[model samples]
Target chain A: MENFLQFNSVSYFYQTKDNEIQAVKDLTFSVNENQFASIVGPSGCGKTTILSLTAGLLTPSTGEILIGNEKVGKHDGKVGYMFQRDHLFEWRTIWQNITLGLEIQKKNKDPKKLARAEELLKKYDLYNFRNKKPRQLSGGMRQRVALIRTLMLEPQLLLLDEPFSALDFQTRLLVCDDVYDIIKREQKTALLVSHDISEALSMSDRIIVLSSRPACTKQVVDLSFEGKTPLLKREDKEFGRYFETIWRSLTNENQKTS
Target chain B: MAGILKPFGEVLPMKTKKQVNFSQAHKKYIKRLKQEKILVVFLQIFILALLLGLWELLAHFEVIDPFFFSSPSRVIKCIASLIAGGEIWMHMGISLAETVIGFIVATLLGAIIAILLWWSERARKVSQPYLVILNSLPKIALGPMIIFWVGSGFSATVVMCVLICIVITIISLLNAFTSCDQDKILLMQSMHASKFQILRKLILPNAIPEFVSVLKINVGMSWVGTVMGEYISSSAGLGYLINYGKSMLNLDLVMASIILLSILAGGMYFLVNLFEKRKQQ
Candidate 1:
């Protein structure tokens, strides 16, 4: 498969009043078409910053980011971002929240997009809650709605920025499976940023480990597990081996940084 | 005793197995709530009656001078005569108009200024200290300046009300707008939404409850402004009546005006509360 998203020696700097801090340093990686890529790193390792760059919320100070062979730009509609929090407007109903992008893009009048929104809600078992406000839903359900809201825009690539972090462990596991299933079913390329090694191992086709800030790619491990679902993948015999490899890489990075 | 009991099951019968009557319990719970509400209202009325009775009894016995303290019956009689003579209505109407106008203008002006401040970081930063100073400064101090600037008339009274309320509105609304969740704003930005779109779709909607609260506060503030303005310079209004009655040493008219002012303030507050309820729904 061709590279759908690429970052070429990307570097980013954050400017404060007194000093400039390097966030991401000389990072290079690529994820192929329809592939699920996960970036695992230590806490505060600028994993979210990298995702922000991909989403075009921030621009890299050096090198280039390419999405489908085209350079990334500010507010590019080619990418969809799912934040750590669901970030659903509490005052708006589920349907209204899902259609928020369309309204912003002035495409709400488009029947095709509206129908797709309805279909996604029904497929995800959220149709019954379409009229309900976001607060009325469970944590997992709200995340699903957040994902569906992003999907309504039909972006070429999806960026998941630790979307499951806020959830409890049980809900996290269930939501990981649900999110993984939906991404694969949609056949869209995705890059997820997470600190949870097990979570990355279960859901990713390719796992890229990163060193501490300013973050640089440490290792990229390609996996061929026996099971399709994340739960089943967790049960795979090799799951433990991959977990150990990533954890050691992470711990080594932490040691070097400290 | 055991033979007489005939075993627990035989004595009570299996059909008589204990079961909670949920409907009856629910009824009793609802009745308790109703009784509490009634008791609250009754106590409130009793407190008012007690206060009024004490005042009336004291005034009747000349323990306090009725001429100075103004007895409840005198105030009531004064209100009745004012109504019969059809004079109080004009004053009430003028005050009400000034308050309503001031309340609306102040709220809108404050909201607009807040939006402007929110739109530019430089503007917000620059104005922060000034806004703080303006908010803390006594609005009544502006009464004389407004009377001269706007000419001691209806305009002056309305201007006074606006000045009092607008500062608070701007401060509160700007706080609301600035404190909007950064993540939600980023969400909108990621979708390529314009600033206005974000404000309209997220920030404005998010600040609605704050806006309602601002309205609630403005209702009271505007009344204060109007009355203060009228006291400074006015030919008509309840404030004028109070001031005029004071000059004439007619305590009954002053007390009556005070009562009327309370009723009008209460009515405005109730309207704002209704608006809040409707928005919540």
Candidate 2:
């Protein structure tokens, strides 16, 4: 697999009236194609800041980020971001909401792209509820709709920002399996930021853990589960041990902060 | 389970099932009865009764002179007399026409100008201060100047409404465009979305809520603009009716005109509300 997205020694600062607050300090990482990677860190550890940088929403104060060997000077739309909130427009029906990006991009005129979007909705079991509004759907279903909407854009990279955090525990487990299955089947690369240890452990092929604020990579853990999917992986005997290791890494950082 | 909507933990198990059945049936009954709707109607009736009763008592005691205050009765009688005399329609027509013209014209111009300002960053920076000063300047104070420029009647009324509404529409829509969620915008930008794409895709649709809010605000403002214009320049319309009544010391007609204006204003307000409800749907 090719190294499709690379973050090279990136640093950022938030300049306010009084002082400058460092966000990502000399962070470096690269994700390969078809990889399911999760970035876990303490609150305000600049995990989101890193994604923003990779997505080219911010100019690095130092170092460069390369996507397919091109420096990210400005925003590139090949990144699909799923925030904690679904951000689905309530006024629009499910199908309309999903095709919103294409409509705005005027790609809806392309029959091939339109078919792909339609097929994705059908594939995801949302075709039946195509004309329904998001407010009419359950929390788990809405997140699926949101994911399909992002996938409709045919983005090269999918960024998940604690997407399952808003769901109940039971729903979270189900949606995590649903999402992980979708990402793998689609064969798309993903970078997920999450606080849930089990979720990250189950879903990710590689986990990049970060220290507290002015965040830098603390450790990178690689997992190989004999199970086929995240749900099955969660039932593996080593699940608790993986959770403990990640929890200990996180708790040790918390102690240092105090 | 959507636990926010119920608290069933406190009930005993066997009886809880019975209570759940009872509550479920009771809930259906309440929903079928349209309790919220009934409460609204009940509240409206109570308020009407209280107002009418207070007015009757006040009139009975002569605490407010009938000749001066022209109690609710006098206003109703004035409406009845105006109808019998076949002048109510004439007054209603003039006022309605002025309001409709002013509202449509102002809303169209306001929306157009807002879009224009949103399209250009330099134009926004350039026109912003002038717009702020223009918006801040009381439109009512422009009444005499407008009457001078447009020379009374329809054009003056329309101009007043435009002044009252356009600035607000521009400011509201411009703010809406800028206030779009940054994360969503980033998603678009990474796609190499064009400026037009960003505007059409991201900003415009999100701006609908703010646009609706401003439309509601514009309804009342346009009424003010039209009536104030009528007061300053017109020989017809509800404003003219009140001015004529005041000039002749016919307090009954003045009260009648105000009641008529309220009805028209309320109707416009209701129309905007209907649009909002439709948008939600």
Categorize the docking of model 2.
Answer: acceptable
RMSD of each: 8.0, 5.5
lDDT string for model 2 (B73-128, tens) is 77888899998999888877877787777777777787777777778879889998
Candidate 1, residues A1-258, lDDT tens digits: the string is 677899999999999999999999999999999999999988898998998899898999999999999999987698898989999999999999999999999999999999999999988888878887888777878898999999999989999989999988877888899899999998989999998889999999999999988999999999989999998999999999999998988898778667
lDDT of 1 by residue, B1-281 (tens): 23212211122122224656668878999899999999999999999999999999999999999999999999999999999999889999999999999999999999999999999999999999998898899988988888778899799999999999999999999999999988889889989999999999999999999999999999999999999999999999999999999999999999999999999999999999999999987
In Å, residue B124's CA in model 1 sits off its true spot by 1.5
What overall lDDT, based on C-alpha atoms, would model 1 receive against the true structure?
0.92
Q: A1-258, model 2: which lDDT tens digit per residue?
A: 676788888889989999999999888877888999999988888988888887777789998888778887665566888888788877789988888888867788889988997898877777767887787677777888889988888878899999988877777887788888899999899999987878899999888888898988788788788887888998998888888888889889899778
Q: Where does candidate 2 chain B have its weakest 10-residue lDDT segment?
A: B7-16
Q: Model 1 segments beyond 4 Å from truth?
A: B1-27
